[model samples]
Target: MASREFKDHYREQRIFVNRTIAAVLVVFMMICVLAARYYYLQVVQHDVFSTLSDRNRMQLQPITPTRGLIYDRNGVLLADNQPTFSLTIVKERVSDMEETLTSLSDLIEITPEDLASFEKRLYQRRRSYESVTLKTRLTEDEIARIAVNRHLLSGVEVEAELIRYYPQGEDFAHMLGYVGRISEQELKNVDPANYSGTQYYGKLGVEGHYEELLHGKAGFQTVETDVRGRVLRVLEKVAPAPGADISLHIDTELQKVAVQALGERKGAVVAIDPSTGGILALVSTPSFDPNLFVTGIDTASYQALQSSPAIPLFNRALRGQYPPGSTIKPFIGLAGLDTEKVNTGTTVWDPGYYQLKGDDRKYRDWKRQGHGWVDLKAAIAESCDVYFYDLGYRMGVDPMFDYMYRFGFGQLTAYDIDNAREGILPSKEWKRGMKGLPWFPGDSINMSIGQGFMLTTPLQLATGAAVLANRGKWVAPRLIRTINEVEVTDVPSPEDVKVNQEWYWDYIIKAMEEVMHGRHGTARGSARGAEYRMAGKTGTAQVIGIKQGERYDADAIAEEYRDHGLYIGFAPVNNPRIALAVVVENGGGGSSAAAPVARKVFDAYLVGSTQLQAAN
Candidate 1:
């Protein structure tokens, strides 16, 4: 029995040993297979794995430049860039954008317009990257609400973006213009490589003209990220170059005052430094806020602006072409003196109307009881149509064209800013070329009196008046005083601009001075309280053809048929600093309607605010 038990125990030990060896072999084979697979992934497929790792662990982000600031002559901020929170979406991370957007809409009131705008931006930005601008300029309350619900909206993100802010708002609309998003058309125009991170461009006025100077170079950065595409840390970065700040020649205070001075009237006022050609104020009434246009104006709003009867979108300062009316008389009188077509003492008999040789078109005088036997000085004072009518016929077309060209008429001022319309300086050649008709003697007669095909923009008139103030010296119309404290470059030399003659200008200046200081001067009553002598001309452009028996009275005529009042002047008569042009559409007389505006401008420029306060 003992021997049998010993044998059984030895057999059991052998069986246990065999089972232990088999289990160890099985574990060894499994380890070998896992090790081989690991080797294959780590070494043979290293590049693919490395690429996947980079996709999860690295990111590239754009660093946008700060937009340049705009300041007026007084250092008041006009256009500024402010930081604001915008909602964005990362398309790759978004599982269901419609659901995410729907939930986001609950946090903040989202209009169909907002959704439409967002979708447009999304398509433009594409899905591989973050798409901006679901909601912009979010309020504090909205931001708080979004933050609380951020976990619920997986793909939604709140990011900081720069937005354009026009602090002065509607005050500097035309001059400051506005900045807006870069459109596909604008993108095509811009070099994609250069503007990789830039988002806005100037749309008009000074802003549009200096887009390159205002939009600075872009920048970039390489960042390390986690597996979930979260930025971990910056690996490399290049700082963006900031945009150049711009200082305009515009005076915001004077601009404000001028716009206010217009009240509800539709008109335009342009004032420039006669010596330097710096525009002090350019006001076009019925203006709109430029900020409204910064983020792509809606079709309805844009249509309203376009269709408004006041034509707010029309740049009257640069493009409104109207017969200069009596404003052309001073220049015409000067032309006569320069061409030796008429002397200062030259006289023409006026019985309230004038008639050409065979043409029965009686060019009637504004004064039914005309000034009899009027000289050049007397004619300018009374604005005697008969006197100018006689002189214009004698001066003829070619000579008048040459002399008018000297006064910056019928030509674009070519001011530093673009979009200035060259007003019609209707010459015999121009009439013949454009209309394909021979120049008529009657056309010259009418043009001489600032009528019939003779048109001048507000800018052109301001420049011409400045030329007269400069005594035929340097006068180039300027809108930008400095670009980032750097004086504007390549300003045209005043000495380069050719004028009639020095003696002629002297005589004309004396005559214009008399128009304000002279006892019989038309603008004399308007100049009574001014501390300084103002050389000016009063003009009333006839809006309708009058019958031989009709008398013009603004109250009697329809509003559309009423006369346009115009005034062009320079202050302190002898040595002028500020030259201005004012136009009041359908505002009856230049002396009554336009001269006061010029006087106020003169008060702002020649007589400083301190002086006005002291006097007050």
Candidate 2:
């Protein structure tokens, strides 16, 4: 029995020895594999491994710079950046997102918009580890509440964002424009790299015109973070460069004066410094607060603005096209004299109406009882329709069209602003092309009186008046005096577009002076008692067609169907300093309504009557 036990024990020991040998072999092979991997990573694949390690541990972040401020000519801040609080979400750090969001909402009030906005941002961002904005312009109370409950919430954070705020608000809204959040369309159009750190861009006017110069370059920083996506420390930072400053040519004081002067009246007044094409004051009535458009405008509010009868959203000063009425008479008078159709000594007989040979339609004169016989200077001074009718027949439509084109009529003024419409300058060819109709003699007669297919913008009229005042020199109108801190010099005078004899300019200017100073002058009512000579023309354009035999009267017509008062003029007959144009929609009598507005603008501009209620 003892011998058998010994043999069994010996066999068990042999089996144990073989198993131990196999286990040792496996352990040696595992160590060899680990050693080989270490050699490959540390030596052969050093760069690849190092890069992966760095990416896992380090982060790159953008540092947005402060946007430059904007100020008016008088140093009043037009656009400014104010600190605002916004709630953001860090996607990667979030666990149980619904629970986290619920906890956050409990702390701070989150609207349906907040949740909708968050979902939009989540889909827009590619990286789950990245953070996006959930809400903007959070109230102070909301911020404090969120901060207190921050410990309960994960992946939620508050950030300070510089938001654009207009202190003047609605006052200079159209002129200054406003900035807003960039849209998808804009993202496609703009350089994503350049606008990476920029949240807002200028949309129109001065803001849009200088977007590139105002939007500074973006910068980045290296940061270290943990696996949970928590930034531990900033490794290296590159400070961002700020945008350049822009100074406008507009004077705030003048703008305010003009805005107030145009109170309650649906009209436009554009006044400029004649020496330079610097737009001193541009007023378009019923202007809305541009701030409303900066942030997303609500549907109700947008609809209200759009539906408003006053059309507060329209930029009438830069865009409104209207028949210049009789305002172009002075130019036509000049045209007539320049063409030698009517010299200074030329005279015409007026029998209260004008007839074209056999045409029974009497082109009636404004003065029903005509001033029997009048010279060219007297005719312009009195706004004699019959006198101009004769000149129109003699000068022909082609010559008149060519002359007016030189005066910037029916053409865009090439102002340093966008969206200026080129008012129509009708010709035989233009009529045939645009209206698909043959030119008529009656069209020529109407065109001669600044009517028919001819049209002009308020800006164009003001600029044309300036050119006349400057003695045949057209200066491109401008709203911004300087850009990117670089001062813009006076625009060079346009090459003289000869319309008439050089000596004829003197006769026309003298006659225009007489229109303001002469007893029979139609605009004499408003022109009287001016400190300096203001050569001007007053026009009452018929909004509704007058019957062949019916005389137009404001008291007899519906308020909406009444005539529109129009005035175009320049100050100081000899050394013209300011040129202006005023249009009052449905306001009767150019002398009583529109001329006074022009007088007020001229007074405020040239004589410095910033505060005055002079005779209307």
Kindly list the per-residue Cα lDDT of model 1 for residues 1-616, writing each as its tens digit: 5555336888899999999999999999999999999999999999999987776777667777888888877787988988888787777778888898888888898877778877876767322454567777789999999999877776677888888899988778887778887776787787676677566788888789888877777778878965445678999998888889988777777787788777777788998877678888888887898888776677789899999988887778888888998888877887788778888778899998899878777888888877899888788877888988888899888877876787788776556677778889888778888999998878888888888888888888888898888777656787777777888867764344344567777777777888887988888877887788888888888778777777776788778778888999987777786788998888888888888887777777666676333322
Error of 1 at 199 (Å): 2.8
Candidate 2 Cα outliers beyond 4 Å, as residue runs: 1-57, 90-105, 110-132, 226-232, 490-493, 555-558, 609-616
| Prediction 1 TM-score vs. true | 0.88
lDDT score for residue 46 of model 2: 99
Q: How many residue pairs clash in each candidate?
A: 3, 0
TM-scores, one per candidate: 0.88, 0.89
Best by lDDT: 1
Q: Show pairs that collide, candidate 1.
A: 249-481, 410-425, 474-494
